[model samples]
Target chain A: MTQRQALSQSTGGTARGPALALDAGLLCILLVATPMTGSLTLLGETLRSALLFLRELSDWMTKKKLLAGSLAHYEFGVEKLAQAWTLAIALAMIIAGLWIAGLALDLIVTGESQTTSGGLALAAVTLALVTLRSGLQMLPFAQPKPRAFRFASLLVMQSMITLAALADDPSIALLADSFGAAFVALLMTAAGARLFSTAAVDLVDHPLNRKSEAYIAELLLEAGVEEEELLDLRTRRSGRDIFVELTINPSRAGSFEEARQRMGQLRRALAEQRDDLDVAIRLRAPGADSG
Target chain B: MPGPTRDQKSKEAAVLYTSLADLAVVTILFFFAVFTSSLTLLSEAIRVALMLLVEFYGLFVLRALHRDRLRRFRFGIGKVEQMCNLAIGAALLFSGFWVAHSVVAALLSVQAASTPLGLAAAAVISAVNLLINLLGWLAMAAAARDGDSAIYRAQLRARAVKLAASAIVQIAITIAALAKDPVVATLFDGIGAAFVAGVMVTIGFKMVAECLPDLLDHPLPGETKKEIEAALLSAGIAGEELLRLRTRCSGSLPQVELTLAPAGCASVTDYCRRVTAVENHLKDHLGGADVSVVVDARKPAET
Candidate 1:
């Protein structure tokens, strides 16, 4: 295993544990509050929280399995599986979002808003919990910046809707609750759409960024590989694993031994620069077909 | 990367046409489901919507594959297809749960019966849906008849399940609309929705089970492995020179990676030719496969 992979395996659970616990706690609170208050907004929150909980649970389980070395046999590691999980989460979010939106629209159309007596209290509690959750997620160890930003935006939106629901008129309060649920649904759908696109690209083996590609080429050149000798170079990323495959015509070296030594140097140099990288160097024979 | 073959193009076109047809049917069903407010129709609508999502996803992946857009992937598009299947199965399971939940809620609540007009509309729409699903099933079956990939086979199976569910929906709606007894109507409605849920769960479970092992990079079947070994032996690759051989499936594509200790080859050119020959031989034997052969130039005693 590469050093980065080892580090990730050791610290993966620690990084995700607190966030998962927070999500579970918030999910439980919303689950209990949704039925008690009959609040559509709370129901939406509960569903969103449940999906988030599932996502975290899957990540945790995958990391645990990685740590146990059970997934080592996978040639490309479990990066594709992680990408698949992301796709699943995106689909679930979109489905949940549409369902919630449908329910809210039905209520609006029928003009049969139920009296949610404790909705304000439930909203306040949830807003507080989500605020805390967002704060925790912002910590470096918790999640990626984009995800943290998503949660933070959700906090702002949740706060706005909660304030709106504090109206004196019951009818206005109900409208606020319905609109709040609709807003939550929109947020979820947008996030899901973004995640879906990213996962789709990754699953198709999108190439590494140009800067990284340039750096790898520079490293190979620095390791005494000639520019013309480098026949082909391909780089791609899956989850946290980066793969670099190089096809080289090592005719510059006088013998196979010298060529082998050059390949080792290239591998060691690349490994030192990026621990997550898996490098494959293919020595092409003169007059051989590229295939 | 090579361009997609004639058979591949035909398969892609078939998938695209089916998905477009599904989109049209689902769009119409959505409106009818909203108007009728029949639980059975609503469940069917939701189920079809989910299926459409997966169908479109599969179509996108298929197009990408045919266009050679994913050539940078060393293992080909097998994992991507598997991921698509996993998403489809997961979506099916989710829809099944939602349908089951709605069914339970309806059974517990004292609900008003649908208007006569609504019931009539639902029955008509369901009958149309049944016919569409039947046509889709046949189309997919024809497409998969030539022995296609995992995605195509899965689509065929999904189409079959959709056909069965559509039949159930049509019958349930017709019975509920004609039956004089309210109890019988409600019972049939619940049963129909429950059956749809059951169908979804069963197919979803099967897809997930079949795709998970492949996604996990489990080895190819023992028989296939033996064949691969025999093929390698016949190709003049001695057991000692073959340092490592790993075989796995990506969707329906077999992937084989071989590491060889380039022992007695007169030159690098000779070794490359030998490896190329071995790859071609294996590809021919395996029908088609992604075969990668790497030469380990280090001596066995280097360690």
Candidate 2:
């Protein structure tokens, strides 16, 4: 196997197994609670949880396939697939948000107030436990803190909504429940839209950020490759891997061997910067077509 | 980098106009679905909305290509196209599930009544949807005929599916309106929604299957591999001089990378010319491909 394949395997092994398990448990609780309470807020939360569960399940399955070497044939790696998956998740989130908002609006307009039930209480307890667990887990890992915080906030909001539904005053309860559903819907939509835009840019094959591009230029200069000799430089990212393709006119070099050595030095410099980079250098004959 | 050809620009315009038209029709259909409370119309609306999202995405890709925005991508934008198709397929799959669920729910509640006015409205909107979809389909077919673009072909296929689905929706809604028995009307509505779901699943599976191999960078077909070898031989590359050859397709563009042992050439310039010849021969043989040929100076025997 190639170095990339080995790297892919290592990346695959880091799949969030515990997080997936937690999501599955949350989904089960929401599934049971959604039908019993008939609260729009709970239903919206249920749908969101379901989508999150599916996303994690798909992520796990893709990583399993990666570890099994099923995707080893992909020369460019499976970063695009990961980006596509992110896009899918974003689309699903947006759809769920719209669906929830529509249902909440219907409830408000039709004056349909659902009664509180034991299921809602149980769901609230479950959310509290999950939120606490997620927050505690984030204490040890700084990288996942943002995601954990988001999850915790969503759960806290759901718990508060559930508590509102359990209020004795029917009129106030209905208002809080309906408004809470709307709030969750808006939150989901805004978050999904943000993720969608980011994933869309990646799917469009945008080049690396300006900082990375500048760094690459600095590296080339350090390797004794002049700006004028560089005919082309292209950089893109797929998943966790960075791909750099360069075309150089080596006419000024004393010999072809010396130019080849310079290319080798540039490759080493890039590799030292990032192990996940895949670099390809092409020597262009003077006056040759860059295409 | 070269800008998109006139042919490509024209194709992009066709896609953009049709997609905008589709969005309008689907939006009208969705409101009508709400007004009429027609299960069939709702299913159609949901399916078309998902499809239109994908159509607009394809159009965005085409415009980007025409504007030379993706010129820096070394392997071209084939992977991007495939990824877009894959997303469309997933959306279709989700639509199928939602429609199936709606069908089951409607069947379970057979007493659901439809007002005469609502039924009439549904029938009329379904007809309008069918007519617009038919026009869109024909336009896509004509556009696809002008070029061998994978995006256009995929768009054409999607249009055909939409046309068929609209026809199904029209027939089902018409029958439901005409039937006197409430049970029969509900049954027709359920069947219509079920059939549309089936169509979504079938096309979604095809799109996903077609994209996976290319997206996964599977090797070129045997025939194409043989053609590459023949082109290399025709370029006067000795069998032993060919150190490594790898071939894969990115979207519709074939990508070939070759590592050659520089044994026969006398100087670096001679070797460069030979490599260029090999690259040109392969590109010509493959019609148009991203071909990169390099000298493997590390080969012990060749060195």
Q: Comparing to the true complex, what docking class would candidate 1 get?
A: acceptable
| TM-score for predicted model 2 compared with the true structure | 0.84
Model 1, residue pairs in steric clash: none
lDDT, candidate 2, A244-272, per-residue tens: 77878767665666656666667778777
The C-alpha stretches of model 2 lying farther than 4 A from their native spots are A1-70, A111-115, A141-145, A209-211, A252-258, B1-50, B67-74, B87-97, B112-117, B143-148, B181-184, B216-219, B233-244, B295-303
Q: Pick the candidate with the highest DockQ.
A: 1
What are the chain A TM-scores of the candidates, in order? 0.85, 0.85
Which 10 consecutive residues of model 2 chain B have the lowest summed lDDT? B294-303
After superposition on all CA atoms, what RMSD does each candidate show versus the true structure?
4.3, 4.2
Relative to the real complex, the DockQ score for model 1 comes to 0.30
lDDT of 1 by residue, A135-159 (tens): 7657766577777766766776566
